[model samples]
Target: MLTKRLVTALLTAVTCTITTAAAVPAQAAASTAIPVPSTGEHLMPAGGVFEAGTAWKLDVRNAPLHANSAGMVKTVADQTAALYGGVAAFNAYQYSTSFYTVPADQPRVDVQWDNCQGKNYTPPGLLGPEGQFTQVPIPADAVPAKGTDSQLTVYSPSTDQLWEFWVTKKTADGSWSACWGGRIDGVSQSDGFFLDGFGASASGLSLAGGTIGIEDVRSGVIDHALALHMSAPGTWQEFSYPAQRSDGFDTSVNRVPEGTRLRLDPSVDVDALKMHPIAKMVAKAAQKYGFIVTDKAGCTAVVAESPQAEIAATGVDPWKQLMGSTPSYSIMKNFPWGQLQALPRDYAKRTVAPATPSTDPGTSPTAPTAVSTRYVSDTTFRTVRNGWGPVEKDRSNGESAAGDGRGLKIAGVSYAKGLGVHASSEVIVPVEGAKTFSAQVGVDGEVGTNGSVVFQVWNGATKLADSGTLRGGQAAKTLTADVTGASEIRLVVTDSGNGSAKDHADWANAKLLTPVATTTTAPTITAPTTTAPTAVSTRYVSDTTFRTVRNGWGPVEKDRSNGESAAGDGRGLKIAGVSYAKGLGVHASSEVIVPVEGAKTFSAQVGVDGEVGTNGSVVFQVWNGATKLADSGTLRGGQAAKTLTADVTGASEIRLVVTDSGNGRTADHADWADAKLLG
Candidate 1:
């Protein structure tokens, strides 16, 4: 609607803005400088108000415009009226005017509404309650008025409520300015107008619903659909719904978005296009309810709502008597915005496709194996715009299971949501030229202290590999990259530090490792010498020697419930039943090669697995880098298993520290089964 609403208010973090401007003098505002509410107060909330509209009939309940089209709506309105030339460029007649009832001294000021909902909007900025958004006895100098992308409906039948406004200045610098409007209780509003679904304009929908407002030209007969307006907008998102392009389309894509409906050609013949009984009753409501391209002005227009709605419905002012009332703005000054017509918009009913995975997180055998040559699932990736489907698993908002688990999680990264907001996902590989793309990411639980989750890898736009920050559930970094043939590969996922709060994130077992060619021309014979890269040593477990561990949130790998090993780590192992924060949670850490003082003897097995002192256990310690040496004695949750020994004497580097046995972090998945240090 304006190139897709500043990219849908920066990916739904909505903010709008609009502040200063002037110019709205079209007469009205001298009833002795307006003013009448001496503490009467009741614009809305008496029953919510409604009624006061007059003279307007034809609306046989909707959906019925007979006469088949053999002319595909004037051949797409002559191919969009050949872009601004023919049909006199559909000029003038723009109005979003309103006033079901106004006279007690018109004006009514005192605004302030802005409901911004991006990442659910927070920090002292709701601006709703207080006076329900004033607007009572207005006129105060009629307010440095002006207009540009304007709208000012105003229903209030005592409270049936409907007061709409955008760029509605002079209502007395009240509050919720431009990116600030709303009140809507129900004048039907075609279903969505505010309450977040949006539509005070900028095409997220609703311009007095299907618009032609002035009670549809003294109810002459133009049932639904008729909101035309355009300075440019030829086509690229013919708008619908209360409008929704949060971002996209600027000097190009040629209009046709906002809530497009289009019509005309119920067999053409409107008295041979003689038009003008209000342009053939708005071309028979565009041959039965159709025209809706909503906005983008400066030239082609069709909005209206003033004339005090024909002096509050027929108190005379026959619109100065000729053939008009809401002052017909000179009855269609040559109407025909190029015969218009662009209907048939199925765009998958409204986008959201790529999400195939039935079993392939690349065969998830506890995850992590498919380094490519063929693997799939970046949720089956698909973005070059097709309506981003998969990566949306919202998890209500309390996220975990590594931030929204399964399907491409994107609830504002683990928490606070939206500062450096990011969430990518793609995959179209099979290039076969030069490859190497690995994955094992993490982040949806404890990174807390501040938060961090960066894990990039692009090929289309270049950026090769990143794993940089990472936290929640800690320990997970295998990211790799080297592409050459590149077919599309991507991943992105961000919130790098602090901002996106809890930073929920994960990508365990991700894969795409390809590079295996072989073929020598003219008679076999290969082997130029190569082989030297395999150093996999450093395995350690606890929870009593080796009850086998690895349960990421649920059923991770095996052994965890004997009432959560009821407090035991004494040589037989099995303690941590969830209490992980920094690095290892379901306990397990190692990096030995000691032998400094007495050669090595670190011993393990500790305790604390649930209630004894409530939920606290930290009998596990032994470091080298931030030096701690040895310590294991702090068990309560049921208690059992205890054997702590240390003798590296000089120590070189053999880390392991789980802490938080109580007081703060808990779900305690801490246990170090069979953790070694024998050297």
Candidate 2:
């Protein structure tokens, strides 16, 4: 989340159409450049604009491999010394394998690892012998009809190499294959090894719709790379093709915590959807068609009727119940559905149809027969046992039995007659021997007015405590009154002395005092703490530079106007007439640090306002003397915060500025803001 002031500032500064992108380099790949547009004569590299459906592939099968079974060991022994020396003798060959899917409906790509078999002592755990692989599949009934990609990068760690892959497209015969190739090889094989490489445009294959696969294919390469190294156990990671596909639990290594799930409030947050199109689609679908659980086998099971039959009995189209036309359901891996479980049949008068005998003979005749014998029962109740009741009931008119013996005012501005002030008048069951009262309060209005609603808990006639008014309608709060062994409880609402304005308060869900029986202590309450870095002194002059930086008013600085200096700094700065330049250079040698602790990221804003420029951008960087720490992003005139959130450790100096090294612009607007850290 961003701070209120920071959000406002960014929103104001970056009002023009802005675009962004991100890319990470691979150690074994060739240099890659963003393609720029061609002017009337000169051709320029693209800045950050990538065509929406552009595709690419990454091949992992062409890399190293091990075996899934042990029988292949003898085959390598026959020619172990012919290729290298004793190195290939005991090589399990299976230790360097990738996982691939053989689905029932699709042809699987055949991979050959010998293409990547090293001719020298490349040494396992040092560099990789992985290469790009592709083959058309032959249609055969014995082959699985379908296949999915698998994650093969997991083996790279054991092999002491960095590996990555992407599925690009299928051949006419349906064999899936990768399109890019790169490897970081020739290093000491050890744990925690790290390397960096760049994937050229050819290596930018997108994994958007592909799976990573691993297989055993090392017999031909066992003795090729070394003389005495032995193989180790090989493991492969799994990649689900459809982004929404889930197999029981995610196990993807990138899975979100089990307890925390993504939730978007549609009414107040529509922009979040734009960032995660797939998740937004799922959310919208969940809201439209009440969610159906996916089985352990990854199959979505349609819900014939809601577990809460009473709600289903309302004749509400489950699909139409969605806030919009989107469907929603809880995504659970271990959901239990042996027999249907529904709560007591309670109605909202208009919420559901009145209980009527099921015309179908199979509909239980015995259940209704038992209900006719009593208006209420003492034993535990189930949904089928209780019939739908009236929505309106006679509730105590602000009567109270508190120690003070005073009646509290219960009526107030409500959204509807049956709601709000009259919520208590609706049917409410007294929890036998309950000492507290609970109610669900919700608001739908701007933060200010929504935050002003006052909530209170009362015992009969006396006001025991004020639960505090709800200020925002976005979040829901459960208010409870503490009073042991009480027979009844009341909820009180006040408008804060304001008149006639109903902010759409919905009190449809309310219940009388009921305490959860527990001998254990109640959940502890704690407040979250926020931290900020302290301010630093010793400001340097001309310590900032960039391609450019701008604000809402216009360009703050264009090019490196401060001229040459021992260091990069810009304390007192002004803009130049140039629209874009090579880069912003600082005059002061010293660096300025921005505090960003307990924050997920840091972002910098640069460029001029109102005017568009070609190759115009602002990049935030952290440096340790001459060593660069991080490069945040290329800025656009009036662009939002593009944060640098990767791990930042042992960084001493930080700077913010802009540059247009790749392409030049003619607009005379640009400037920059110190990087802002966000949690």
Total clashing pairs for each candidate: 79, 101
* Tens-place lDDT digits, model 1, residues 248-356: 1332323344444556556666655544455666777676555656555433455544333334333443223323231233344335545544543311121222221
Over 4 Å off, model 2? 1-428, 431-487, 490-591, 594-616, 626-679
Tens digits of per-residue lDDT for model 2 on 57-104?
111112121211112222222222222222111101111112111112
The CA-based lDDT of model 1 is what? 0.39
lDDT of each: 0.39, 0.24
Model 1, residue 36: distance off in Å is 27
RMSD in order of candidates: 28.8, 32.0
**Residue 501 CA displacement from its true place in model 2, Å:** 26
- Candidate 1: where are CA atoms >4 Å away? 1-195, 198-204, 208-225, 228-260, 265-276, 284-290, 293-306, 309-342, 346-679
Candidate 2 residue-wise lDDT at 64: 21
